[model samples]
Target: MPKSLTTSEPNVLRPEDFDPPLKRKEPIVPYYWTLDEIATELGVTSRRVGYDITGYPPRKIQPSLKAYKAGSLFLVPDADALAYIQRFRERKKS
Candidate 1:
Protein backbone atom coordinates (compact mmCIF):
# COMPACT_ATOMS: atom_id res chain seq x y z
CA MET A 1 0.00 0.00 0.00
CA PRO A 2 1.36 3.48 -1.00
CA LYS A 3 0.64 6.62 1.08
CA SER A 4 -0.06 10.00 -0.68
CA LEU A 5 1.55 13.24 0.73
CA THR A 6 -0.28 16.60 0.45
CA THR A 7 1.70 19.73 -0.55
CA SER A 8 1.43 23.04 1.40
CA GLU A 9 -0.96 24.73 -1.08
CA PRO A 10 -4.31 26.38 -0.15
CA ASN A 11 -7.40 24.65 -1.68
CA VAL A 12 -9.76 27.70 -1.45
CA LEU A 13 -9.87 30.41 -4.11
CA ARG A 14 -10.08 34.17 -3.33
CA PRO A 15 -12.55 36.54 -5.02
CA GLU A 16 -9.69 38.68 -6.35
CA ASP A 17 -8.08 35.61 -7.88
CA PHE A 18 -11.25 34.75 -9.83
CA ASP A 19 -11.60 36.71 -13.12
CA PRO A 20 -15.32 37.61 -13.27
CA PRO A 21 -16.70 39.43 -16.29
CA LEU A 22 -17.63 43.05 -15.69
CA LYS A 23 -21.40 43.57 -15.43
CA ARG A 24 -22.73 46.85 -16.83
CA LYS A 25 -26.17 48.28 -17.64
CA GLU A 26 -25.05 49.62 -21.01
CA PRO A 27 -21.84 49.60 -23.01
CA ILE A 28 -19.84 52.82 -22.98
CA VAL A 29 -20.21 54.49 -26.40
CA PRO A 30 -20.41 58.03 -27.81
CA TYR A 31 -23.86 59.21 -28.98
CA TYR A 32 -24.45 61.99 -31.52
CA TRP A 33 -27.56 64.12 -32.23
CA THR A 34 -28.26 66.88 -34.74
CA LEU A 35 -28.69 70.49 -33.63
CA ASP A 36 -32.29 70.63 -34.89
CA GLU A 37 -33.22 67.40 -33.12
CA ILE A 38 -31.54 68.53 -29.92
CA ALA A 39 -33.36 71.87 -29.99
CA THR A 40 -36.68 70.14 -30.60
CA GLU A 41 -36.09 67.69 -27.78
CA LEU A 42 -35.19 70.47 -25.31
CA GLY A 43 -37.88 72.89 -26.58
CA VAL A 44 -35.47 75.74 -27.30
CA THR A 45 -34.08 77.68 -30.24
CA SER A 46 -30.96 76.26 -31.88
CA ARG A 47 -29.06 79.49 -31.34
CA ARG A 48 -30.03 79.68 -27.66
CA VAL A 49 -29.07 76.06 -27.17
CA GLY A 50 -25.71 76.70 -28.70
CA TYR A 51 -25.18 79.85 -26.66
CA ASP A 52 -26.18 78.26 -23.38
CA ILE A 53 -24.15 75.09 -23.81
CA THR A 54 -21.25 76.24 -25.95
CA GLY A 55 -20.38 79.91 -26.39
CA TYR A 56 -18.28 81.31 -29.23
CA PRO A 57 -16.40 78.72 -31.27
CA PRO A 58 -19.24 76.25 -31.09
CA ARG A 59 -18.71 72.52 -31.33
CA LYS A 60 -19.61 71.70 -34.92
CA ILE A 61 -19.60 68.76 -37.29
CA GLN A 62 -17.54 70.72 -39.86
CA PRO A 63 -19.03 68.92 -42.84
CA SER A 64 -17.55 69.34 -46.30
CA LEU A 65 -20.03 71.52 -48.19
CA LYS A 66 -18.55 70.61 -51.58
CA ALA A 67 -19.23 66.90 -51.35
CA TYR A 68 -21.74 64.85 -49.37
CA LYS A 69 -20.15 62.05 -47.38
CA ALA A 70 -21.66 59.10 -45.52
CA GLY A 71 -21.83 59.47 -41.72
CA SER A 72 -20.99 63.15 -41.92
CA LEU A 73 -23.20 64.24 -39.04
CA PHE A 74 -21.58 66.06 -36.09
CA LEU A 75 -22.89 66.76 -32.57
CA VAL A 76 -22.05 68.16 -29.16
CA PRO A 77 -21.80 66.00 -26.10
CA ASP A 78 -25.22 65.36 -24.49
CA ALA A 79 -23.70 64.99 -21.01
CA ASP A 80 -22.19 68.48 -21.30
CA ALA A 81 -25.61 69.94 -22.12
CA LEU A 82 -27.15 68.09 -19.20
CA ALA A 83 -24.46 69.43 -16.89
CA TYR A 84 -25.14 72.97 -18.11
CA ILE A 85 -28.81 72.58 -17.31
CA GLN A 86 -27.99 71.28 -13.87
CA ARG A 87 -25.74 74.25 -13.13
CA PHE A 88 -28.34 76.66 -14.47
CA ARG A 89 -30.97 75.18 -12.20
CA GLU A 90 -28.68 75.45 -9.21
CA ARG A 91 -28.04 79.11 -9.96
CA LYS A 92 -31.78 79.75 -10.26
CA LYS A 93 -32.38 78.10 -6.86
CA SER A 94 -29.82 80.36 -5.18
Candidate 2:
Protein backbone atom coordinates (compact mmCIF):
# COMPACT_ATOMS: atom_id res chain seq x y z
CA MET A 1 0.00 0.00 0.00
CA PRO A 2 1.26 3.52 -0.94
CA LYS A 3 1.36 6.14 1.84
CA SER A 4 -0.29 9.57 0.96
CA LEU A 5 1.40 12.82 2.11
CA THR A 6 -0.76 14.59 4.66
CA THR A 7 -1.67 18.29 4.89
CA SER A 8 -2.85 20.37 7.83
CA GLU A 9 -6.24 20.77 6.07
CA PRO A 10 -7.14 18.37 3.28
CA ASN A 11 -9.93 20.69 1.92
CA VAL A 12 -7.68 23.77 1.52
CA LEU A 13 -5.81 24.55 -1.76
CA ARG A 14 -2.28 26.07 -1.66
CA PRO A 15 -0.91 28.70 -4.20
CA GLU A 16 2.29 26.60 -4.64
CA ASP A 17 0.24 23.64 -5.85
CA PHE A 18 -0.80 25.38 -9.13
CA ASP A 19 1.20 26.94 -11.99
CA PRO A 20 1.62 30.76 -12.03
CA PRO A 21 -0.93 32.83 -14.00
CA LEU A 22 0.11 33.86 -17.49
CA LYS A 23 0.94 37.56 -18.24
CA ARG A 24 -1.50 38.88 -20.82
CA LYS A 25 0.03 40.94 -23.69
CA GLU A 26 -2.21 43.85 -24.70
CA PRO A 27 -2.78 44.61 -28.39
CA ILE A 28 -1.80 48.01 -29.84
CA VAL A 29 -4.83 49.74 -31.32
CA PRO A 30 -4.57 52.61 -33.84
CA TYR A 31 -6.22 55.89 -32.87
CA TYR A 32 -8.83 57.56 -35.10
CA TRP A 33 -11.02 60.71 -34.88
CA THR A 34 -14.46 61.30 -36.32
CA LEU A 35 -15.18 64.39 -38.48
CA ASP A 36 -17.17 65.95 -35.64
CA GLU A 37 -14.33 65.33 -33.23
CA ILE A 38 -11.81 66.87 -35.64
CA ALA A 39 -14.01 69.92 -36.14
CA THR A 40 -14.42 70.28 -32.38
CA GLU A 41 -10.64 70.09 -31.91
CA LEU A 42 -10.00 72.64 -34.69
CA GLY A 43 -12.75 75.01 -33.42
CA VAL A 44 -14.58 74.81 -36.74
CA THR A 45 -18.00 73.66 -37.83
CA SER A 46 -18.44 70.12 -39.17
CA ARG A 47 -19.83 71.60 -42.40
CA ARG A 48 -16.60 73.59 -42.87
CA VAL A 49 -14.57 70.45 -42.43
CA GLY A 50 -16.80 68.71 -44.99
CA TYR A 51 -16.26 71.57 -47.42
CA ASP A 52 -12.49 71.32 -46.85
CA ILE A 53 -12.73 67.66 -47.74
CA THR A 54 -15.12 67.88 -50.73
CA GLY A 55 -14.17 71.41 -51.91
CA TYR A 56 -16.99 73.96 -52.08
CA PRO A 57 -16.82 77.25 -54.03
CA PRO A 58 -14.15 79.59 -52.55
CA ARG A 59 -12.70 76.71 -50.43
CA LYS A 60 -10.11 74.71 -52.38
CA ILE A 61 -10.02 70.95 -51.90
CA GLN A 62 -7.45 69.57 -49.45
CA PRO A 63 -6.33 66.24 -50.81
CA SER A 64 -3.99 65.72 -47.84
CA LEU A 65 -6.91 65.51 -45.41
CA LYS A 66 -7.60 61.83 -45.72
CA ALA A 67 -10.94 60.57 -44.46
CA TYR A 68 -12.21 57.01 -44.44
CA LYS A 69 -15.91 56.26 -44.76
CA ALA A 70 -17.25 53.34 -42.81
CA GLY A 71 -20.93 53.13 -43.78
CA SER A 72 -22.34 56.58 -42.91
CA LEU A 73 -19.55 57.38 -40.41
CA PHE A 74 -16.29 59.10 -41.43
CA LEU A 75 -13.03 58.37 -39.60
CA VAL A 76 -9.70 60.20 -39.78
CA PRO A 77 -6.52 58.53 -38.60
CA ASP A 78 -4.63 60.33 -35.82
CA ALA A 79 -1.46 60.96 -37.87
CA ASP A 80 -3.38 62.13 -40.93
CA ALA A 81 -5.50 64.49 -38.83
CA LEU A 82 -2.36 66.00 -37.29
CA ALA A 83 -0.79 66.44 -40.72
CA TYR A 84 -3.90 68.15 -42.05
CA ILE A 85 -3.99 70.51 -39.05
CA GLN A 86 -0.31 71.41 -39.62
CA ARG A 87 -0.97 72.11 -43.28
CA PHE A 88 -3.99 74.26 -42.46
CA ARG A 89 -1.89 76.29 -40.03
CA GLU A 90 0.78 76.76 -42.72
CA ARG A 91 -1.84 77.91 -45.19
CA LYS A 92 -3.17 80.42 -42.68
CA LYS A 93 0.38 81.73 -42.08
CA SER A 94 0.97 82.25 -45.83
What residue runs in model 2 are displaced by over 4 Å at the alpha carbon?
1-30, 57-64
Q: Please give, for residues 1-94, the per-residue lDDT of candidate 1 as tens digits.
A: 1133565553432213222311222322344334544455445686655554334454553421121112643354444433333444456569
The list of candidate 1 runs beyond 4 A from truth reads 1-30, 53-74, 88-94
Q: Write the per-residue lDDT of candidate 2 for residues 5-90, one digit (tens) a residue.
A: 77453433222322232121221234666777667656679887777666665555554466878777677776666556655555
TM-scores for all predictions: 0.33, 0.54
For candidate 1, the TM-score is: 0.33
Each prediction's Cα lDDT score?
Answer: 0.40, 0.57
lDDT of 1: 0.40
